[model samples]
Target: MPLALYLLALAVFAMGTSEFMLAGLLPDLAADLGVTVGAAGTLTSAFAVGMAVGAPLMAALARAWPRRATLLGFTLTFAAAHAVGAVTASFPVLFATRIVAALANAGFLAVALTAAAALVPADRKGRALAVLLSGTTLATVAGVPGGSVLGTLLGWRAAFWAVAVLCLPAALGILTGVPADRGRRETSGGPALRVEFAQLTGVPLLRAMLLGALVNAATFAGFTFLAPVVTGPAGLGEWWVPVALVLFGAGSFAGVTVAGRLADRRPGSVLAVGGPLLLLGWPALALLAERPAVLLALVFVQGALSFALGATLITRVLYEAAAAPTLAGAYATAALNTGAATGPLIAAAALTTAAGVLGPLWTSGLLVAAALLTALPARAATTPGRNPEAAR
Candidate 1:
């Protein structure tokens, strides 16, 4: 990986911090905003919805724009949204800021996926993406805990302000480090919107994207409710919540590091082994929730397995959409965020029922079981002259 890739990852770290920090802050934010916890959780859903909808739309509009400019534009916009969010007293204003930040987040992620792929050899795209996504894992480890502490001590707004400040250096780094020609749009056949959409909507790519989406949904369904689960049924003190998050993050980092090496070469084999293991881990987690030590251990296990499957399917989406080039980023972003968006809503509904804290685990398990079905291999649809008829 080049220095530019690391720069992009740094930028992603800033964005990832803002994105992941919400899970840890939800309880405090709900109290501060004077709303029900479930209502406060909608902020996350709105962010995901914005990403799900905005990624392709923004990418389509900016497809012909310069990549460096596009990235900087989104970065600045994202920072400003956080800045706005930090000062807002009204929950509706804060809610609107999340949508804005998410739109900017979606555009940056969509473009960044292509930018990362363009920076590496075809064979290394999997590793490249892992390097990029490690930012999210790192956020889980450092950012979430730090934000939790901040929310616990300094109030939730401070974490939002910190996120806003984090973006400035990322924008500067992107401006100075990422090479102009290497990062942006080109005036080629790919710049045509019709061709890009046609490539994106193809069944093979769509199937691959669907698998990625489902696994991510499963991951977030459990993750979005982590603090509550840890405090309530796990019998852990409030202070131990960040400790639980760190354990999950550490496991995730390990999983993705291992995944980077295998994703391109043995996706099916790894998915076969890791997918079933991850599915079982979820229900086991719910069953063992009352045992703090056991619950914490399973949290780590689930995090590792969930991200391994997550990273692998993400790489698979990129592979299936190889023909789309630019819009591959949008397709992948849309898939992951769409899943992220759906999981929280499902978990929220489960919370409204008698399921309570453990409900998210069952919700996660169901999605994981569904995701496993879509993990089977088929002929690559993005491959020209290949039989599109190969069963997905």
Candidate 2:
């Protein structure tokens, strides 16, 4: 592993913390801003929307620049956005800050993944990408929890301030650690974007990757809204919320680690098993949320399986996009962000009609099932000695 990969991971840790820490402080933010909890939750949605829209746009626009410079610029933007967010008192102003921050976040992640791929041997790519993405898992386990504690202790505003300060170090790490590439590869007109899009859409493997992402998104949508569901109907306490989240994060970390190894050995098999396991785990998770021990056990499995599938899907995309790897990396980020944006919205609608959280959980389970079904066709299409790029 390169030292640069570690630095990139650190930057990802800070970015993930800044993006997700808001969830832990939502109630506090709502109270401080005199808004409802539903409204406060939009802060997170706002960031997701930014990522969904900004990632592809930024990637397209930065095609001509050196990868190092693009990454550095995005990291600086991330730090600046967080700094502004920390100081703002007005609700609208803070929202705008979040949007800017998310844009920066999206661009940084898109570039970081591409850079990670560029830094390693093709055979070792899955492991390199896993190391970079681990920062995100670590954020869920450590950064969000720590930020929540800090927000409670120092005030929500202070939490943002801490993230802002950390960004300075993250920015410095990127600037100093990432290697410079002199090659300036320019895409020809809109054709480059169109070509990549066509390749991704045309490839069966890529389609499967997108389907996997969509299914994952749908399940996550329900899971994301789990706190309200568990607390309102399951009769769980707010404290239990963090416990479940922590358990979920722990499972996710384990899954990512395991999936990386599996992908190296049998990428197709990992995708096959992971998708079904995720589908199976959700129902158990929903049912068990009512029982402390059962809920903890189920949630852990749910998190682990979800993350393992996530890792598998990521490696699958990289393999599919090997022809236009940079564009593929950007598309993978875009597809996942699209899922992130879509999942919560779908869950919110389901929660409206159904009696309780069960509706969303069932809906999420079905999505996972659909994703699993799609994988069968995907697996069958794999050809022996097929140059991976042709699959793209």
Please provide, for model 2 over 1-392, each residue's C-alpha lDDT reduced to its tens digit, 9 standing for 90 to 100.
99989888988888877766665676778899898665666676677788878877787777778877788788888878877877878889888988898888887787777778777766667788789878877877788767777776777888788777777887788778877753234565424666766766556556745775676576466556666654665677666666666776788789888877776457667666677777877776666666767766777787788777777677666666666645666766776777676666666566667435566676678778777666566564332223434433
- Give candidate 2 regions above 4 Å deviation: 182-194, 229-237, 357-359, 381-392
Task: Report model 2's TM-score to 2 decimal places.
Answer: 0.89
* All-Cα superposition RMSD per candidate: 3.1, 3.0
lDDT of prediction 2: 0.71
Candidate 2 residue 383 Cα shift, in angstroms, is 8.0
Per-residue error for 128 in candidate 1, Å, reads: 0.6
> What residue runs in model 1 are displaced by over 4 Å at the alpha carbon?
189-191, 376-392
Instruction: Identify the candidate with maximal lDDT.
Output: 1
Candidate 1 lDDT, 41-66, residue by residue in tens? 78888899999999888888888788
TM-score of each: 0.95, 0.89
Candidate 1 differs from the real structure by a C-alpha RMSD in angstroms, to one decimal, of 3.1
